[model samples]
Target: MQGFTIIEIMIGLAIGLLTLLAIYKLFATSEGRRRTTAAVSQAQTAGALALFAIERDIRSAGLGFAGMDPAYLGCAVQAYKRTGRDPAQYSFPLMPVQIVNGSELRVLTGSSTNMFIGARYSASASGVFTMERSNAGFQAGDVVVGTSDTDPGNCLLMEVTAGAGSDITGPGGVAEDDPTVRHLSSGYTSFYTGASVTPERNGGSSVDMLDGGATSLGEGWLFSLGNRPTRNVWRVQDNQLMRYNFLDETDTKSVGVAEDVLQMVAEYGFDKDGSGKIDKDNEWTGVDAELVASKLDRLMAVRVAILVRSSQYERDAVTSAAPKWANGSKDFVMGSGDDWPHYRYRVYESVIPLRNTIWGQQQ
Candidate 1:
């Protein structure tokens, strides 16, 4: 065979090598860009979805049961159990917009049409609360909240243990003091003795009780009794945004609102003057049950900040540094350990108004 020069063969090999190198570079560049884009998109989508649910519930906060007057939507009470894997998971219950320690949020929702309407509930000195409503739909083990729109400070929440029809009893009072004729201990039955009931108390509705010996729910208090008292809670847990429904007493199931959510922080605005407008000077850097109960009526707005990260590796391995969120002097850092190079981050934030409470102000 005709032999080629050594230089010619070498040149040909070099050209082939160059072409292969170019292809590799192109692939690497494209993959880097793709990962970056995907990370950004994921963060954006997660942020939007989380904010939507929060805003929706925040706007609906303090909403009363259907067919009920809007005037009743007020911050009535703050009560919640603080026992869980995460302390933030449980905080005080505020009727409308309840910010717990400026990190967690709880909103209450309900409809008046489902349960007993216009039913009156009273708490005896012994802590027994009785409800009397014709055709009352309350059942044993049902969670209920007593609220007075005009009197936000006075509210009662409890679990019904007896009665369903015209009479209902709560988890309080001595066993002997219970209405014996109605509660045979074997089962719940409706028995309305309007005449036999003490004149100081109206025996028309069923009676229930809450522990702690606090007579918060007084006679003539408006009733929003229902088996379903929708209490929505939102917080960041284990790098994700989570929601817990207090209404579902049994499950206490937590649903993931968004993934890769790193942190959630908030600021509250108050309408200290009843002017129907939020005042900046009245802003609360943080809030909790005490603040909610003491200043709930004055709260007018809330601003929340959420931080999220990418679910997959999106950065070049050469740089192990995690992404940082620059918010002026305060920079939020995201990512850690071996996967730090694999992710990017973004922040989603919004300032939402408490429309229900604001609307109540206009009236």
Candidate 2:
């Protein structure tokens, strides 16, 4: 073979270098695409999980209160634990607790001390009390007294008989009997209020009315799926989604529950009848409890949209897209135009029945 010239050798080297560079670029492009697909999938999964959790809780909003007494519901009962008056003196402490105002559901569980300590003055109002008991063998109007003669702080004791005699004695007088007594347990107490009682912000009881002004209550009760107080608007700060109790005045900042929550949207489903449907006429407004009750089967659907913005991709590849519209653009947008910016949009929707409403009908 003839020896190759310097120019020929240089040309051959150039061709080889160009081919290698192209192969490297192809691999890099494939890797980038893989990562982008994974990011999108992850974001979708996260959004779906969040939406499901919210819907599950919302569906059970006002369950287990329709057949019970109004006082037990606590929505209609004004004061829960009496500090000065006698238990028998007043109407058996109409469920001594209520679900107050907050973004999430709140339930007031009385202190154990207040529930069983009988014959003692109703002075301290802060303690974990029992609200229901199936084994206590107590009726609807029986007083719950302290059975532990030694500790007096551990267990709740109930007087099986109602309106018999004053279990609590006062200054030269005996405590009266409460005709509306109800029992409760530790985990979750379902007071059998005949009518539904929605608590007001002022710590007073109101029937099917939500307090529009008040912000915080020591025992602010919000009824959701499992009778535990839950927050609605969770905050995402410092790359974390946190849970905040709007009723907790002390906890200005909430605790983090999830991370990387880019967006969340909530929609109220107005079931005009117990039959679930999205009737325009039966939507939730400031007035109309009947509509609320009849629509008690109302469903709350939460749509959580999240963006998985990671540092792995090149910023130049990102594009600004238009937002997707659901429930119409007019309901969510301001101004009479479509000049709004919508970027890479993903939505997840979850429907939950308001378990706390009489309309739910099904537990």
Winning model by lDDT:
1
Which ten contiguous residues of candidate 1 have the minimum total lDDT? 197-206
Candidate 2 per-residue C-alpha lDDT over 250-309 given as tens digits, one digit per residue, 9 for 90 to 100 = 234556554445444333445555455555633533232332343223433222223322
Q: Candidate 2: minimum summed lDDT over ten consecutive residues — where?
A: 88-97
Instruction: For residues 1-363, write the lDDT of model 1, one tens digit per residue.
Output: 889899999999999999999999999898878877887798889988998888887876655432233333343443332233232223244456667766788777654344233455543334344544331554443444555433544444544444343333456742332331121113232232222211111111222222223435444333444445567878998988999876443224788889878788776777656665755454544555434444456667777778777766644563355433223323455434676555666677777887656654444
Output candidate 1 Cα RMSD.
Answer: 9.1
Q: What is the C-alpha RMSD of each candidate to the true structure, in Å?
A: 9.1, 13.0
Model 1 has an lDDT value of 0.55
Alpha-carbon error at 189 in model 2, in Å? 17
- The TM-scores of all predictions, comma-separated, are 0.64, 0.48
Distance (Å) between predicted and true CA of 71, model 2?
11
